[model samples]
Target: MAMAIRYERPYSHSAHWARRLAWVGLVVFLAAALSHRFGPLTTPHFLVLAGSGAALSALAVVLSGIGFIRLWRVGARGGRAAFVALLLAALPLGVAGYAAYAYFTRPMIYDVTTDPFASPPWLKVPVAHQDFLARPPVTLQDREIQATAYPELTGRRYEGALDRVLEGVRKVADEQGIVFTGEAGLENVISDLEDLAVKPDGDTGGESAITVVPVPSARPLEEGFLPRIGGPSDVLLQGEWRSLVFGFRFDVSIRLREEEETALVDMRVASRYGPHDLGLGAAFAERYLKALDAQLLGIAGN
Candidate 1:
């Protein structure tokens, strides 16, 4: 038996584009809603921000409603459907608008609380931590970032050739009163600078990459091991060199708090380099981390 087939050409290109637009708007809406729910749901700032978002959403919908009334005046039969879709699209507009407001309005005078381990799910593992994780992720500019390309960015801070990073770390541990400081754990270090690329230029550009090494590990996070999206990532090793390069990109950030609390955030560096740049990247990373880690260790100890 042959199956009957029917073809309808009722859907126009304009409608197709409209549907695509609706989907895009929906994605934006969902993302904004999730961020609002997860990022700052309980704070007073969040409430204020959400209120503004709701108001903006109402405004956009109201504008569309006015347009709908105008369409009805023109004798369009289904102005109602247009109004619904238009209002829905404007939902995300409110989200984006309010988020912008939150960006400029939130108070920067945050107080850090010391509740101990408020560890997120991504930070947990079935096995006990052989060592603390490498430095936690960071939010640089507007995005979460990590130093995975050069060792210097992620490694121990050094004052100069006379300074050893390990010694510096110990000194800081004593200063901060970090009592649990036997071997916090090892960090993944890197040596290549070429693989790190950002958006607006190559496959990714508008971003710059460099690495540092030798920083202590911090607590883990509640994120999943998502597949790399291609940027800069590091893998640690137990060889003459401490870190290895197994991936292209990594996202990292510092833990956020309402106040200034003691937080230990570790960092790492890694990369795949060419024949000529092995020393180039490693040396740069080492130098960078030496100085940077020195600053951090000072903080940790203090």
Candidate 2:
């Protein structure tokens, strides 16, 4: 009698869904990231969710990698899923790593002021009962940094009458969408001094036409990274580039002092908190000055 040949059935790979699990983890992480960026939840809550999701996704990636290697050895399936999952996992990982690097490498100061020598004073009266963020006093170190980083930020001189110079400043600020504060309007009050037989274009002790603009508030984010959003952000990076929450605000000011046939316009932008401005102050001043220069040229032509 001949014995029948016996063939054992091949076994399926254990944890074949490892890669699928990684995919799910990645999805969770992406959702968390979106929520952190655009969702109405506060910073702390967003950080927690993001941190948890990243951890889970990372673990899943590791497990999926191991599973893929094992499956290959065993001649099992799911090679494609494993590879795709690994690739997907890397996207957020790379982003997080880059953000960490940028955060760590960011400037030490959070406040940016245009006039480092004599920064225009910020006067936001504290709201009653509600704690208000106050503008940071300019420090020597901050001035030094501003001077070094923004050498071209010095005031520019223009030859024009007081009203004309003031109009130029106003137009520039308006174009930039900066609203003038009451203090800035006080320049109009001092415009009477122009009639003292004093030259409005000379530096013969004529009051400056000032324009104060409170920086616009940031919109509720729809989706984006921290640095990509509004200036003077409440999110601050501290030790090891960790998050330090501090609600803050920013404002910009233009002071145009009249001298004989010349007006010296100085711009100052500052945050209510932090010492480093991420170089935003310098950028704002540069743009404003350029716009003012163009506006004055237009006026001269007219």
Candidate 3:
């Protein structure tokens, strides 16, 4: 009598674990990214979730590598699962790796300005309390690094009136999806100098004496009798910009000054929260300047 044949197929547990970890990691990464983008979670929380996901993904990669070794040596039945795990882990791992590369290669600065000597002041002040990272002030060394790394990020000088240049600036900003938050020096204040006149003094009797007096008008003049010479005429615009994919916040300040027949434009961009901007501030400033140049193509000057 012949005994009944028996057969058993063994599968690699490492491959199965790798697939499960990859799936879990991918889900966590997506949740973290979506929550951060939609404002449901703070940046610090998001970072924690993202880091956890990346760590899991890295572990999955290692497990998958081990699974492949086991399959070559012991002929495991779960090779397909290992391959799928590797593919699934690639997304989060690739993103984390690229971010690491940027952090290492790029300048470690978050703020950039066209005029480093006198950067444009922010019309919309940042909130005193931030949720996560507290951005540090841009130092002289940071400015030097920015200048060396991005020499082309310079101010623009256009041969146009303040009003015209302002219009172009607004248009470019709108096209670039910058949301205006605050503004200054955009309105014209009518001079009160014309409200004063030389009136004949009644106390002078028959003498031809005259005295300068304030003429009563509907609008009250500002305090002090002397007329102000060359008041603040520079225009400043502050806005908030966000990245298309990640929605990272950035604060932007644009200053326009009228000098003779030309208007000078300067911009300052700073990350809302982070020590390093990954070279995005300079890129944003350059893009804005180029768009403004295109807007006033014929009026751009050296």
Candidate 4:
């Protein structure tokens, strides 16, 4: 007897999403081409560009998964060739096509880190599904410190990005401190940390007060498809943010820009949602602030 091959069809939901992602991904590819054909995506809006592309890639992934399930269930008798092509090329094509645009367009051009800094690869898998495996990081009082401007990132444009956010956080902490502990600022900082960690993307997780956007906010000169069509997973990162309320754990991503260089400072203590963690997101942030301050001290050597 010939070895039997299994034929499986995709579930309804999976097939639906897969079809949707394929269409969306194709549109993104075309927009990228048009952008390159005309003028590349410009500054003050690069983050939005990048965030959109990243999100589209994610949607493509969702679609591909759906299609694969369909193929597995239905068998390749009807669409085997198309299924195989998409399954193999889905992510690679997305990565290669978009990466090429990113290299040339560089929409995330924040002018922060000229020198290379370390960053792990992409989440590599679903953040929600992955096990924390450890406790989250936290910080204590008297540890928080301020960050300095990078030498390469000049001009007021970059600084303007964080000014409002920094001021709002600082002011709330100060006000809360007068009535609570003189350490109100620390509490406020922790509260903000909580917001970042817990809130999910608007579509799936529901919208919160916080959302990420480009620096030096501006309305583009003309309309474009990719920018016009926003999708889920626009959120680059988030945390549990319990440090502000119940004193849970958290972490934050710090971007540095001075002159023309942009650098990222990601401070973590323990692990978030991990079994062993002390759940101290604020405390870790406090520690990061201190470490940043120390780095500044060494660089300025004062």
Instruction: Write the number of the candidate with greater TM-score, choosing between 2 and 3.
Output: 3
Q: If the candidates were sorted by their TM-score against the true structure, best first, what order would they fall in? A: 3, 2, 4, 1
lDDT of 2 by residue, 1-302 (tens): 99999865333333345556556667766776665445554434544555565665676677677766667677556666667667766765665566467446555555444445455444442221212322354587877876776777676666555566676777777776566653443333233333323334655555644322211112222243322211221111111111222222345655655544455566666543344444554666688777877777765312
Candidate 1's displacement at residue 124, Å, is: 19
Whole-model Cα lDDT per candidate? Answer: 0.33, 0.52, 0.77, 0.33
Model 3, CA-based lDDT = 0.77
| Candidate 2 runs further than 4 Å off | 1-106, 125-137, 185-249, 272-275
Question: How far in Å is the alpha carbon of 135 misplaced in model 2?
Answer: 10
Q: What would the per-residue lDDT of candidate 4 be over residues 1-302, giving only the tens digit for each residue?
A: 89999866434554455455555655554455445334443211333343454465556566556556656676423244334335533553655565456445422121111112221112221133223333232222112211132222211121122223333333433332211111111222211233223354564654544433223312122233322111121111222232332232233323222122212223222232333222133334454444333333222100
Model 4 alpha-carbon miss at residue 48, Å: 2.4
Return the TM-score for candidate 2, rounded to 2 decimals: 0.53
lDDT of 1 by residue, 1-302 (tens): 99999863232332233334444555544554555445433223333444554544545455455445655555433354445546566666654565457445432211111111221111211121212222222223111111222212331212221113334434543443222211212332322223222234353533544323323443344255542221122121111112222111111111111111222333322222211222222343344334445564443221
Choose 3 or 4, whichever is better by TM-score. 3
Clash count list over all predictions: 57, 16, 0, 46
Point out the higher-scoring one by TM-score: 1 or 4.
Answer: 4
Rank list by lDDT: 3, 2, 4, 1
Q: Look at candidate 4 and tell me the lDDT of residue 243.
A: 37
Worst 10 residues of 4 by lDDT: 178-187
